[model samples]
Target: MTHPLVKRYNLAPHPEGGFYRQVFRSENETSSYIHGETRPALTHIYFLLLKGKVSRFHRVLHDEVWNHYEGAPLQLFQLHQQQLWERRIGGQGNEYAEVVNAGNYQAAQSMGEYSLVGCTVAPGFDFADFSFIEEPAMKQWLDIAHPDLAKFI
Candidate 1:
């Protein structure tokens, strides 16, 4: 069954898995050296990850901040500086917000029924600036580095 939050937000399936609805896009634009293009100063979206679904590992050119809104805690994972890091957002003993640096590979999943979170990106977000990790290369790296994290791929 579809989660009520999904219906409330009218979210659409996201390419990375789960569902999302963009909530904000700043009208102000800025020239980003990181992206080499002018883009909205900020962008925000409501992201929902249902039980048993994962947000596949992906990277963006700008930093992303996630704010947990409701539902189960979200287990967010990041591959940064060749190290694997895990954080639980929302619920007991978990933080409400997390920041992922630019260029880090990130993924997440709900710890229970579902998780509703908001992601804010600086310099906005564009499909051109997003990319999923090549599975084979990521797998090879995981085999030598953090094999346990391979499930995220």
Candidate 2:
């Protein structure tokens, strides 16, 4: 089936060194994002995968819940006490589960989905959640891409 255009989300940097992202319809995995700091009560994130799956390899700085809006299926996992505990939350094992304390977990091709919504507390989520985790340390790219979001820090 023909899908929507793949989005190119790019955050800009500030004079000093920080990052920020535009707030837009998360479902619109095509083209859009708002400027300035946005803490949405329910910020939905859509992952348009080139392959059939997507990898959200990182940690949820703030406790959040994910609802699979659209995709093949989802395998949610988390790092609790430095241990990996996984489960097939989308198949027969369970249905519509929320991952907790997700840190350094590789949801690689396993994280199958084109879109998912991460609901957080009011005034919304900041950089703590935008971690493009490559390894142990956070790359801290947003700080250089969109300093505006980092300004809040």
Candidate 3:
């Protein structure tokens, strides 16, 4: 069955898993300072996750903020320099918005049937700046460091 967000936003399969549609892209370009290059100032997307689906661990060059719009709560996990942080993005959680820092490995999934969320990226998002942690490498890292945190991936 198609989720309402999938239908409304014309979301497509995202490399990270689940579905997403790019809804906004800034016209102005800005220097990242860190990247030492000019890029879109910002970008926005509508992201959807269905039950049993998870957004695989990945990292981007720019910070991302997620806004809970509707549906069930979503679990977001961030692996930062070997530290694991968990946050719920919806429902009765203390926060409805969460930020994932640039260069940190992050992932997410729906707690129920589905979750409709929005993501905003500063410095925009380019495929060239995206990196996915392969399962093999992740398993190896988890085996020695964060075995208990593997479930989030």
Best by lDDT: 1
- Residue-wise C-alpha lDDT for candidate 3, range 71-150, written one tens digit per residue: 89999998876677889989984588999998888989999999999999999988888888765866587667866556
Tell me how candidate 2 scores on lDDT.
Answer: 0.40
What TM-score does candidate 1 get on C-alpha atoms?
0.93
The worst-scoring run of ten residues by lDDT in candidate 1 lies at 143-152
Better of 1 and 3 by lDDT: 1
Which run of 10 residues does model 2 get worst, by summed lDDT?
12-21
Model 1: per-residue Cα lDDT over 1-153, one tens digit each: 778888999999999889999999999999876947999999999999999899988998999999999999999999865688899999998889999999899999999999999999999988889998876866688778876656567
| Off by more than 4 A, model 2 | 1-42, 48-53, 91-93, 102-123, 132-153
Strongest candidate by TM-score: 1
lDDT against the true structure, each candidate = 0.90, 0.40, 0.86
Candidate 1 local Cα displacement, residue 110, angstroms? 0.5
| Steric clash pairs (candidate 1) | none
What's the TM for model 2? 0.46
Model 1 superposed RMSD (Cα):
1.5
